[model samples]
Target: MNSSSSQIDVTLTVKDSLLGDGNTGGGRYNYTFDPDLIHVTEHDTEIVYRLAKEDQPRFRIVNLYSTDTRDQLDELEIREDGAELKIVHRNTYQQLTVVSLLVHDTKHDHPVNCDPQVTNDPPPVGP
Candidate 1:
């Protein structure tokens, strides 16, 4: 498990125009992941999720949950004062896993929901 195999950075931005005036709802925000879909390979020992510098002070990842718990992830940790998540995946058989991130907005004192996808499918053996 090479922890340094890959690193993913996530960013959060708000669409003020979509929210209209004086609205602080979760719908206004957009969460963008660098690779969007994380593909865990055999060499991957750890997967890290971090907030972009611009969004670090504004939001924090409070909790994370996977839709399928069995054979998807071995261990999960929320670190860096809830600004990052470290995940260890042992089973590389699962095709798709949806990880839901519970985020808290420090600026607005509200909660936001974000879903990220993870897959352990091996690369095509041959054409």
Candidate 2:
């Protein structure tokens, strides 16, 4: 398949309500995307992924980032099982309105250029 089509790009925004809850030890949030759209391997390391917030909060006390590691950062964990991607928030609390998740294979020498437009609406609540 083509390089651009092989890339996986997803943007997520937490609702205002969820953002508020983030202040009080945020709970685990699950996000699922189509596995068929991108390639998936048994090993998690095959996919190079990065997650970040589109807008930063005012306070530095809270930490916001995406990780696949379990209980590493303030008990914050992010797990990926095939098509499913789970987000966990630990000790720190902050509002993450806009989230950008990019995933692509590392085997390719050329960069995967898939930049989706930003949206204000939050991602769906359920898995």
Candidate 3:
């Protein structure tokens, strides 16, 4: 979480294993998002999601929407090339926001749901 910059870049990559086993038709591939918890500071204004493997049949960001109505996002733009998403945040009071990503696995033709958190509050200290 770079407090100096107004924009944050989150890289999304496919995980190694499937969600289920052969019983579930091989299942959907899981994903790993760098900076899994987006610590959006007061100065941060935007979030940019980029694919880890460009032009690969692994995963594609199909749609993005806020699970919570009180989310801080002001705008969401999916790029024309289906490569990235530019999301602008509404800087109001501090709160935790949940954003869902509908990712399409081009290789398996499956849809995977990814929920990443955005928050202005500092992460809790360890035990």
Q: Candidate 3: deviation at residue 39, Å? A: 1.1
Cα lDDT tens digits, model 3, 1-127, are: 6444678889877654543632222443556678887876544378888778653456677888784465567778887465678887765556777788777777767776777777764323124
In terms of lDDT, the poorest run of 10 residues in model 2 is 54-63
Q: Write the candidate numbers in order of decreasing lDDT.
A: 3, 1, 2
User: Which one is best on lDDT?
Assistant: 3
TM-scores across all candidates? Answer: 0.75, 0.21, 0.76
Q: Where does model 1 exceed 4 Å of error?
A: 1-26, 122-127
Could you tell me the TM-score of candidate 1?
Answer: 0.75
lDDT of 2 by residue, 1-127 (tens): 0112223343332222343333112221222322213322111112222333421121111223443243312322334321223332221222222323433222322111222221111122124
lDDT of 3 at 42: 48
| Candidate 2 structure lDDT | 0.26
Note each model's CA RMSD in angstroms. Answer: 4.2, 16.8, 4.6
What TM-score does prediction 2 earn?
0.21
